[model samples]
Target: MLCIKKPSVASSFEELIPKILTEGDLVETEFGERTKEIRNTIIEITNPKLKKVPEKYPLGEKAVEEYRKNLLYGSKNIFSYDYHERLFEYPYNEERINQIDYIIEKLNQQKNSRRAIAITWNPKIDIEVSKDERGSVPCLQFIEFLVRDNNLHMTVVFRSNDALLAYVANALGLISLGEYIAEKTNTQLKSYVHHSVSMHVYIDRDRDYIKKYFPEYLKYIE
Candidate 1:
């Protein structure tokens, strides 16, 4: 597993992009040809709130803000799944579980709770559908919250991640969620850890963009 430890999300993302370009193995997927891939990559951010968008990041500040809002509170759209719906109103056996509430309550009751976990994957539905038929499947699977030394730490697991295009946005969104949880539980926010089972960049889609904006890393690609 490749581990990247940084003080903020921007730094981690900046480092991650080049690392994947240089160290990742070429792989083919149902989507298309990916330039590079690394499995079980971990990113640890010591301070989630210190997130500043890197100048090289493709998206603008407004776009990133919109994504964070959508991840935290957007309504369900045409897609098969939405992260906000799965987290705030998780579907169970004929019932919806407010996982965010549960996590807050658990932490308030027991600061040392080890069971404050929220899961996005519903096996009954997710396991039965194919991506072609479903339109979208949940890439983020599990989220766990821990409190130690009066600080709350969050860890998230993703089955797959588009490291180049989606990772920075994902990290920022989850950091907002963690901030919400920390406020609700009256704990200070600390580290944010993200784990991706398969972290990759789609070469055919992003090659020109990377070449134009991140020429410094061209040595790795050529």
Candidate 2:
């Protein structure tokens, strides 16, 4: 199973910076070389502790064979075209309003300090294809969220985004939501993500960053 935990605030971004160091990392693959390289670079950028380049990347043929089993895969089940069409066609409707309410309810039910978020980036339905000379298909969904200590945090999801191009916008959007929810709840809103394919890929990209610059985070793991 894929597990994504809430992000607890650090005393400061700098303190959080040291936790992403990279040392003694190991991954071997040719097919995954680009992914691994991006991972390493991100670690290097965030954590200064590693000082040296990792040796396991751009792996040997033998190493790739050995690690093949560890590679990730996803569902092949096809969706009704209606499924994809609806996400774009009726993004904001009564159904979506209920969904936002449901997420708030889930947080209230948790009885813990953690807050929840639902991400709606199903790749099966949200593929980005060129639309025209002046424009293109929507790349991601848009949503708003707020964090408050004892109130329901608000989050709004948008359709279509260029992952790298719009990363900052998405990040800030969630942060704002966490803050807003916290104020409404009269308690700190702990940040969380609802899993969707787009988010999955974003996190994978983030994982690469953590591996490259924040290996110390791996140590904090249990």
Candidate 3:
């Protein structure tokens, strides 16, 4: 596993971009050729409060805010499988479960609880649909909230993540979610850990941009 520890999201993003571009292995996907890919990448943000968006990142504050809102709230039009819907209104056995509420209540009842987890991949729906038919499936798979020493820490797992295009915004949205949870649970927000099974950059799409902005790191790539 590749591990990256950073104090803030912006720093992590800065470090990760070059690492992925230089060290990632060439892989082919349904979309196209990707420049780099690292399996089982783990990113640990020691301080979730320092949520500065990198200046070079394409999205601005407003866009990040919208993404966070969509993540916490619901946006059916934006995503085929919205994270909010999966978390807040999970379907199972002809019933719906509000996982977010469950996590909050669990932590409130027992701060040391390890069972407070929310899962996005519903096998009933996710396994049945074909990727070609759906166009996009949920990349985020699991989320867990833990309260230790009066601080709330969040960990999320993704089956696949776009390291260059989507990681920064995704981290911001998750940090917002963690803050919301911390507020509800009355715990100070602390670390944010992100794990990705496949963290990749779309080379065919962003090669020029990488060459233009990160020319120095190109030496690491073959």
Index of the highest-TM-score prediction: 1
In model 3, state the lDDT of residue 30: 63
Q: So what's the TM-score on candidate 3?
A: 0.92
127-194 in candidate 3: lDDT tens per residue? 76534654567899999998999999899999999887788889999899999889999998889999
Which window of 10 residues has the lowest lDDT sum in candidate 3? 128-137
Clashes of each: 0, 54, 1
TM-score of each: 0.94, 0.32, 0.92
By lDDT, the candidates rank as: 1, 3, 2
Candidate 2 segments exceeding 4 Å error: 1-94, 113-115, 122-165, 190-222
- Candidate 3 residue spans exceeding 4 A from truth: 76-78, 131-134, 218-222
Q: How close to the true structure is residue 180 of candidate 3, measured as C-alpha lDDT?
A: 89
The ten-residue window of minimal lDDT in model 1 covers 127-136
Cα-based lDDT for every prediction: 0.87, 0.33, 0.85
TM-score of structure candidate 2: 0.32
Q: Which of the predicted structures, 2 or 3, would earn the higher lDDT when compared with the native?
A: 3
